[model samples]
Target: MTLSTRPPAVRTSLPARMAGRLTRLTWIDLVVAAAVLVVLYVILRVGAGTAVSFNPARVTRVSTDPADLPYYAARSLLRMFAALALSVAFTLVYAYAAARSRRLERVLIPALDILQSVPVLGFLSVAVTGFIALFPGSSLGPECASVFAIFTSQAWNMTFGFYHSLVTLPRELDELSRSFGFTRWMRFWKVELPSGAIGLVWNGMMSFGGGWFFLVASEAISVSGHRYALPGIGSYAGTAIAEGDLGGVGWAVLTMAVMVVGVNFVFWRPLTAWVEKFKNEQSEATDVQRSLVLDFLRRSHWPHALGRLARPAAEVLGRAARILGTDDRPLSVDPVRRRGGDAVFALVAGGLIGWGLLDLLGYLRDRTGLGVFAEPLLLGLATLARVVVVVAVATAVWVPVGVRIGFSPRLARIAQPLVQVLAGFPANFLFPLATWFFLRTGLSINVGGMMLMALGAQWYILFNTIAGAMAVPADLREAMDDLGVTGRLRWKRLILPGIFPAYVTGGITASGGAWNASIVSEIVTFGGTTLTATGLGAYVAHATERGDYPHLIAGVAVMSLYVVGLNRLLWRPLYRLAETRYAL
Candidate 1:
């Protein structure tokens, strides 16, 4: 018997082998090259379309023809990814600060609550004009504003997830970092990042899907008084709706689903599989996750060859990071000194908050007097009732389902596309049918509003639950199974506690997202009819449409006050419990 020593090769004729020898290109190389070129084409076309669309003197209109859906999908996807990049950057900085510093945590968390509660229209009302002024006649201004709006939809949930990951960082990892004498930067970049990676990726997927509805809405609803849409599928759908072209609208939605699946396949599925490298397990997952794209990349020659070429550069950068990271000792602060520092920070933060409040009050008083506060406050209560109900229902439903999916890698892989499609499918995609049902069934806007908000908000709970379930140690899972843990006993003894921290993060963010969604949910218009629910969102929407800036400001302020107070009263305590009792 004889064994071949050459690298794996596909069957080929003698002439093909001769051609490969002469050209220095194997069949595998050709296939890899084709794949690389296809990826590059998608990237370059997306970038070029986005760049050219931001012309100051030009006005772009969305095309509704089904044939144009592919191009529109590309543009919309580019915009969504741009917003996602911004969200990731913001989460890294903002969440890190909140986790590391007690003083900053107090201020930043509440600020996050308020920011998450502010709806898309509220953001656009301020951001659109400022972006236009900043860019000075460049259409890039409105484009940037649209990205920011989507960014808002994503950033807070991601930030909360990362922050939870940090605060609930496993004790073993912390001890290992201390034992290694790792510098702060090294600890963060190497240890903390991998620890949080799963949570961040899960939350990022949730945010992407959750933000899609806003992507479409932001197109038609960017400006206060008039429509300012960019060239994307969202705009295409909005244009169709405005023109009453049902066929065009249906095509736009089909295009959206395709875009979501494509992104999941190429970007997220690969990343999800790659993160498995960071898992801490004595035994590997029984059914390993797979991505065809990831598998090909690992098997290909070009990428590994490129890595070898870039090794020197990578080493140089690594050396630079070490040189820049001067702090090597673990963080240890004196209790008294920490308290003093917190006191100083509190005074400064309080002064800034106070000044802003006074300014807001003066604006309200001068415009409509103090009596104007009564309406928004009462309306806020209505919205609050709706939010509480939605959050409760979502938590009860998704927590168990997410746990089951998370425990099985095969199940998780299968669910990714289906979940993304569900999360990304905007409620308004079915608004016409819903409107007809609402009228036929005699359903009021109150119930309809709750349903609409859930479409966007519930995913936060599901994603966080999945992340939490995955975070449970492999050894612990095995022990539970060995002991014959099952059903309610299993959930009670292992599952609930393990996922508690992430569930808290999810619940808080979901609540805030529901509040943010109110603007869209509480006000419905279809078939030349308008249905307004008695909530804070309707109040804010009506005020914005009327160009009542001062009133809009008041409405936002009241909404923020309600959200902040609720967080202080409820979610924060649950988070503290997660930290003390349930953290891995």
Candidate 2:
């Protein structure tokens, strides 16, 4: 109409406009955003209540309202996450130290072994007193103590995982890193960390499972005449059991189950899937795990936005690190100076050890005679016997089953969560029920305790075996199939050798956990009745309750000795054998 010189009006198409808008929003995006908001609200609510007075007098006076369950759970989760963060940091430093220095490794590795073998209850006893004194008159003190206890339960295995990974890194990769002239810091972040990620994640998951078994004991602490009932699911369960409230117990169990599932979905699944990138054996055709949450994060604009926000701080950190970093060139020190330093270190260490031995001897002589150690030693032997039987039985039962499940990817996907849930279930929760049955049926406490230990420890063997089987090389599997390997011969020649290393790792963890669980399992209480078995765990628990510090220390020391001895003599040898003969 008009052949007017004016240009036609530019218009945007509806589909194009809609597509632009859709790029900013997906179904997963909305879901994740909503989840974030809810989590933030819960965190704020929990943080608000954390301002309570640190009155030791009020530690035992805790609320048991069902409506407070969510708040309590949030608190417990905060404590656990805090402890886990600390554990991860500790593992990185401790493992790096051990891996980088042969001199330190000799001391550090054995020290870690002893530390891990120390039962959680033993740590709780010492930690509670010290933390309370440090934060006198504040709830924060006991809270810190509880977190420390959980940390002890979680840190050791993760440390071992990282250390083992670092030490076992392929020689080719090590040489490559060195040839590239990577600085120490760069090598750690780029090479060592990635190489160890898979083991660290798996062991971290196992550590979390182990932490749950001690959560109740940590939260509802009653040692050295100090009773603290922290507001958490653990304390809720304890209160429920004390009052015989079946409904409360059911509620607590349901809440715990929900929490475990949520963690698996939101944290572990994503982590496990993400760490596949770090696997040394990953091939182009390897079907890595997929997680919807991880996928959403990867695909969404949120990651880009977060990266942009963090870039400035990261750049600052990088600059500072580079400024302070040492050169990669090897340093040549005078032989005389090096020898002097080594001599000084040796003398200091010897002096400390000698002083400790003298102090320990004097304390034992004055407070508790040497003869008094005989009872706990005998009790330790009894516990050791039970651990041996339980581990043997668990290995027999779970090895074949785990191998079978591992062979089926679909079955493994299903069984993994189930096993995790089972592992997370606190053995103490079953004590009241088991105690009732044993009391009614007149079953021996020793037998019941052994069974309970098995229940607590079997998951380690099963999970490790499953992982070992699943990790079997696809080429090896194909070769076996082509060779027509089957039946007992297949298991004897292929399966056992393939999983031997993993089996040794699992057995060590399971044995340690069994010893720890004995503190709870060897002593069961239902109402006014208490059933105790003659074992080191029972000895420690009784002494702790009585506030008998001397015996408590002695019992813990004895238990530690046994654990260290067995690990050094038995597990260490087996591990070395596996590494030399069976490792892929």
Candidate 3:
């Protein structure tokens, strides 16, 4: 046997080389970028009343009536913008740390695990007081707090996506960066961030949906016996639900669907396509090959001037590095160091459990004769029951369907958009049909509401599992096929195991979404009668209506504890399985 080795071809023509060197960015594009920045600044300054006198008093009154739709819409848009910026920043920071520093990765990643598991309501309870105090008599502070609540709803999915991308980069590419002695900052910008782009887009889409799920509670706050309603889309939804107006709810749903579609078409599609161009299949750039960005910088007078200035700064940095004997070698790693990771996670879990117990004991002690604690425990049980039913049903239906879709790319394309539209459909859109069906069939309102929660949460598992299934290596699939795998045997032997990690990711997110959606789902009203389920969601909704703080806290606490416990017991194990079994 003999082995043959040959050198690869390189570009010969100057024009062909130049065309490849310069990425095409027109002057019009630069103008557009500048215009966007200018317009955003102007809007933030004037429309938001931030740059001028900045008077909350002069910001005009916020009416609870539907007549104030424009006011609330504008506020919601502002908060959405803030949420996007914060999500991007946090994702970059967390993803970078998790990728580059093992010690920081060990501590922060698990803390993020616990933080993400905590509900948006739980976040509000802890932060609302300090957030409000930040402005101390300004309405803007409360407004910003609402934005932070939205941030909590959106940030976690993005963090996970970025973390996954960071850990999963090609080893050859990582080694290449080390060989070149790329600076930490250069590696982050040129390598890590761009590699994470596709995952970030998907996570960003999920996070947007997550934000919408909790919009109602995030904008409306109740703490320490006080009720504060900020102007936003959530308040709009809450009002429509309260008034039993199907038409109004329909309008809101339409607006959301339009926004989702527009965002996907305008932003996500192009971003995905661009990222795909840089995947591992793409040819590597050699040093002898010219880059357009470099050529452009060389030709431009401004860049030449900047380079002249930067040379001295670069020299200073180099000298400092030499004097300090700084090494640029890549760090060696052992996955077994995750043992310490598990210990840190256990400590956080123990603390949260202890806090919940203390609160429960205090409630019992303080309300011995008043019977206040009774409602919370009963409500907690009802919340648990609803979660169990919805999750069990959702998983049963979505898991098999997801595996099929994953195996067929054409099916996945069709199903993905349909799932997106379905997920975006608000619970209120189905309220009329649900109310009518329940009334006609004499079914309890509770079951109907559970349907709404399940509708939203179920999709997460299906889509995520499908993503996981698609990730199964072609070699593995071919091997199974060659072995004559079919039907249940295929699912058991190949498909289920392949997509289990994605299922866990989806399930974790969906479970949290169900908890948030339940607030709206567990309470039903058609016309004159309001049917309330025996759950924390119903309790909180009712309390919000009557401005009852003690009961609201009780409901929030009950819901948060369940969410935390489920994450620790169920989702945590699944996450470990994914990391160990399927993670790249």
Candidate 4:
């Protein structure tokens, strides 16, 4: 009865305060931050000390010692990051342009399908010489070539991801942005980007994995009798395989694993966690991922100080954007001008196609003889059959598992990084191992090659399905549970439909990746032993090795046609069905 009518004074225990501070200093956080700083220092030191002498004669110089692993890894990472940065920028621009223009979308989507199907080896064969010549007399030339090759490996799928996300933005939000009179730039930055952020981040991660998948071919390139070996883990691994040094290969694999783990900690994990804020769906089941490095950065006083230092530069950029930004208003174009532009575009495209066709036919008739084309066509059909079978198998296996793991936040958190690292394990590096096993077991190259292709491509389906499943709304699950929806009925009625869009996305990318992987998988070699499967991939690889440009071009063209045709005839229809029938 005698308690004063005033509030009690708040008190904080010293132990509690100490515990609060300690919570900010996790072991994982400290270790990641320290390792990252050390990596950056080494990268900068190596980059600066290494001159950019574009001497073609010096391009062959590379270290194979185990001690050089760290430096090589650092160099490889720099190229990867450079390629990734370029890929992101290309995605933003290309996806936006395609999304905004119906005319462009008609041409661009099919172009992308064909481009993605063009083997990485094809890019290496065609682009290496051009890139080297672009910066003649400088080491930056070959470096640029390698980075560009990785960029080709990484960019197409990410562009598709962003474009798909943009096209699939919720109708209500699209209308809202339009009603708010958002400018083109403002709409992109706020609406399109944030709407697409989740897919873009996931696909970006996959793109990086794809880059690593082809890193060896890109780094240790031999095109048109010109060999260039850029010092990197990829080159190290390639050399090990070439020398038949199993121990060296093991060491290279270990080094790659370390690099992948470090990359996940420093880049993907933090980015994945941070981009969760951009998700448009408000679902209790959609738990934002946590990253130790992100937590450390947020808690560290230096980052805040650095932000303050960067404020002026950011403001300048903001001002420049505002000043340069165009209005979002739609203009009524003159029909005459529009028709004229369309006609010109059509005429130029027709001429180019005609010329290309003529050249291809001439080469086929004169160099390859028309009779030889049948062989590749038959081989391509076999490869296509293998791709279809492998994709179906992967879908059957991964869909349910991914869905279950995704539904559990704890499990998803645990699995995401592990899967990311596994996906980044260059599938080609294991080719030698597979070859050895196949030789011992006397397995058919076709069967073994399909397995390798599946191993390389199935992660696309797995990871994307996990992402889709995790995004499922908590209320939907709860409602299904309350309604006693379980077993086949639950999946058929709720779960499968919920994840259909993601499954289609994964399926499309996986199929394309499988086609690309066929090039390496079908033509396996370890030291003196070479295993060649009867497929278009092996044909391309053989042609590449022999510097037979006409056959190589023919094989790549046929593969691109098959890929684009399949996407148009199969995947595109399925994608439409997903968007129209099952989109969440």
Candidate 5:
């Protein structure tokens, strides 16, 4: 303690002070971080730039070569980031609406079902035309098509994750927020969003993998007789496949694997760690809420600045809340002013759909005649065949494992990320490899397609099943234990029934993913041959290649309509069964 008094006589060295400061800016660390940011910004700038029309013929000609690898990888990374921005925007709105309104949940859940079920090729086919029309005079139309393709791949899982988190609020968590009279915005940010952390993270991971499933079609743009490819991983792979270059495929695969692992480490890991920190630990009392950021902010300069600004912001938000008719009262045990909500929602939805259809028909008549239309019966069969095979395979693989892991929280946590990593991996990376392996072995096109679809869709079953399994009541588990219901009996009587809701949810989501994946899966480029099977996805893919806008719209419309009708007729009833039978 006396050392300070004696040390006052001793002067601190300037060199020591400078050395300490310099240590903070370690050359290695500074360079690496700065380099990463610079690289990322450059990639983003290029991605957001105008589309480059690299000749498709040249791409085909040089398919298996290693020359354009860097050019293509850079391009794909840009598109991936762009797709990410769109996905986040979509997730925010969808999650918010589903959280806020019951009627929206009803309409949107079905709509999402249809959206997800419609194949990616169908999306590309229709979206390519609509997007082209929007930017009628430029290459922007092709870029828009590519962006939409990415959207189809990534949007569904995130939407479901957000939706699931909103509706599955723990009673205590809801009550705690209500007691504080948190505003709708505060409730969403502080409560619903946090609750959905696991789901959102899971979805983000899945969306990344799902992006891979569509990379080929997104990059290798073919409209009518004109084929355009922007340099990206998909384009590179497509070229590699065309030329039968094993080395290029191998390089792309290695690069993709490295990129996936690195991204997960940097972004997903830290985010997961932060979320895990917030997660309620078993030993911690339920009432305690330790918000690390909030605690820091309370003591920081920003909070004081924010405090000065709060009143004006509050007033604006207050007025908005009043107009929305949301009261400042505590959470009601019963419903609050629920009348006419459904009717209003229904009217709005009907009005929008009516407007959309009329506009669509008008555009159709002007652009192309009705004589080119394909019959609905054939479309339906094609859709059905794809759905049946995907569902069957997904169920068989994910069910038992999902249930097993669901029962154990530790296992579920570990397995969840593994599944996510698997989900994010681009299927295109595998196509060349799969093509190489299958062609030499003489496997059929159908076999390869099924494999591709299965890769994308299987995670849905696993994830949803785990969610359902975790939702099972502890008391029920205890009762089953007491009754000596073990092994097969336990699974049959307790686990299956307990997780039925999640299974249905998983099945619906999986079916959609499978359909989306089928486009690329059904069409294979291997050993200089492009192999395709007859399916709605194939039809849509062909139409997109042809730049046949009318046919494209018709194909997408049929698929979307089929998906919607099927959900209403089949999955809706199953969801009802789960809600009534299992929901508390």
Candidate 6:
């Protein structure tokens, strides 16, 4: 009767069907996209470093006037976030590769250990020259170099966190993916990513914090006796430090406080809340993570519109991905065949490593002689002592505080913003005043340097603890409650076990951070005076400042050795224990 009234419905053509199915741009989506485009346009036009002629002699005009601090702060944040984006990209790829195969993991983990230990200055030594050459005559060259240096500070921690997540992925999630016949892309997109999301977010925050820690060094790049200071809060603060302007430093701190608050509200809070749903909680979490920004955005249609727009590209990539890896199938290989292949690979890799070591030894012996190794080894020991002290102190102070904050949603809401701000409070911010105070008190550099190192590395511990505590299953907590577990008993059984893997991840990065930070922390400057501790960091800094490449290489080499050895001997074992014994 309806068809008769409508004079018979005509069959839709393919094009007509497609047109009907197409997503029409909603008003809200258009509004959101327009706003986003405007902000992007602004970011590209000016905030993305000005392109200037490649001048190796260009000296940045760092103005310390409070009037100029806002723009300077904005520039610094732009560089930071740019680097953060790159770091995330690098982490996804690198950590995935390292996690996928045992053979690769063997090499990659050690390489990563050394990489994270390489100080920011070590990166600048090569990055500045290389990037400048690459861009030829663009301000973007040095800006890229600065961003890359910040990336060096941020990427490794994120990579390690992601790698840990991949390796420690629960057995059930993997089985679920396989049972559903998910393609590799689907598995990674749906199961693996969600499982890792919590750790990755927290680690990303720590990585951001590390970027802020090294901002001064990253922005104030020195190569071949020429200083290329970029227009940033770091550069502004450096100028203030050079002039002994405590007021200027104070102003920089104030600006950073404001910036941190804004970043927390705009970026991190939304991310935290968004990741909360991805969390693998066993029973309903009554204390939900919430963000006003996330809530507001959920009310808008932009994200869905964007997702729809991206669907075609995603489908193409998914097909490409399926060609390489199995569609969530259990990979069965002949053990003998795999072993044979692995052995051949190992032999070739071993040969290359041996050759490289021999070459390095030859070069070092010809220049500084074999005896050059002795001093750095001793200095590395000194630095190691300081690292131990710093980690111990940090673990003692922050574990309870972080755990308490994590378990209490109300406290977490209040404390997270503060921690985010404080975590990013660059240790260098205190160098002028703290250095002055230390000098005034006539304290040993060992005492003062340990304190400064703690300022940088302790946040790693705190961040991981909170992430770990939040991840504890609600059902487990309920069970503990039913069993009348209290205080130490609760901590010993559930809390400690739940948090162990995360703590190990944090500890590894924190330890590495301390080693990396020693390059800045062990060498303090105030006005025209420089105070140096008798440690590998001081040696590396002294070498870099004076253009002594041979000693610099030796100092860096020894430091890497220390880091890699410590990781292989201590951290890696603990990591394995965490994976096996404590993993959810």
Candidate 1 overall Cα lDDT vs. reference?
0.83
Q: What tens digits encode model 1's per-residue C-alpha lDDT throughout 1-584?
A: 88989899788999987787658656777888897798689979776654443543444577788888777777778778989999999999899889987778888888888888787778988887888778775667777888888898889999999998899888999999979987666678778889899889989988998779787776665445656778788888877766667788789788888888999999998988887777666776666578998897877677777979998885675677678764533377899988899889889988998998898788778889988878999999999999999999999999999998888888988898898898888776666656677788989988888999898789889989988888777778889989999999998989999888889989998998888888878877665767789999889988877778877887888898898898889999999899889877
For each candidate, give its TM-score against the true structure: 0.91, 0.89, 0.71, 0.88, 0.75, 0.94
Positional deviation of 114 in candidate 5, in angstroms?
A: 3.1
- How should the candidates be ordered by TM-score, best one leading? 6, 1, 2, 4, 5, 3
Clashing pairs in 3: 21-292, 22-292
Segments of candidate 5 deviating more than 4 angstroms: 1-71, 125-144, 278-348, 355-376, 403-421, 429-448, 466-486, 489-502, 577-584
What lDDT does each candidate get? 0.83, 0.80, 0.66, 0.82, 0.69, 0.86
Show the lowest summed lDDT stretch of 10 residues, model 4: 324-333
* Superior by TM-score: candidate 1 or candidate 2: 1
Of candidate 5, the 10-residue stretch with the lowest lDDT total is 284-293
How big is the RMSD of model 1?
5.3
Best candidate (score: lDDT): 6
For 331-359, candidate 6 gives per-residue lDDT tens digits of 67689988998999899999999999999
Q: What is the clash count for each candidate, in the order shown?
A: 0, 3, 2, 5, 9, 0
TM-score of 6: 0.94
lDDT of 6: 0.86
Better of 3 and 6 by TM-score: 6
What is the per-residue lDDT of model 5 for residues 1-584, given as tens digits with 9 covering 90 to 100? 45554535666699997787566654544555566699878776775655544222342332444566666666676677778889988998887786666667777777787778667766665666677677765557767788788987888877876675566566778888878877776777677777666556656666777786678778776667666565577777666665677787787776666666666665654554445433433333222222333343334444354577987886786678767867554443344445566667789899999999899888887887554455634855765676778788778878999887766655654665566667666676677667766778888766567777788788777877765665555567777878998988998888888777667767777777776676667777766667776677777777777777687787777777777777788877887776556543
Q: Candidate 2 residues 273-335, lDDT tens each?
A: 787676555333244467777987887666676789998885675566678765433535678
lDDT over C-alpha atoms for residue 199 of model 1: 88
Candidate 3 yields a Cα-based lDDT of: 0.66
Model 2 residue 26 lDDT? 71
Residue-pair clash count for candidate 2: 3
Q: Write the per-residue lDDT of candidate 4 for residues 223-275, one digit (tens) a residue.
A: 76667888889999888888888888888999998888888887888887787
- Candidate 3 C-alpha lDDT tens digits along 419-490: 666765556556666777888899886677788888657767776665565555556777777898888898
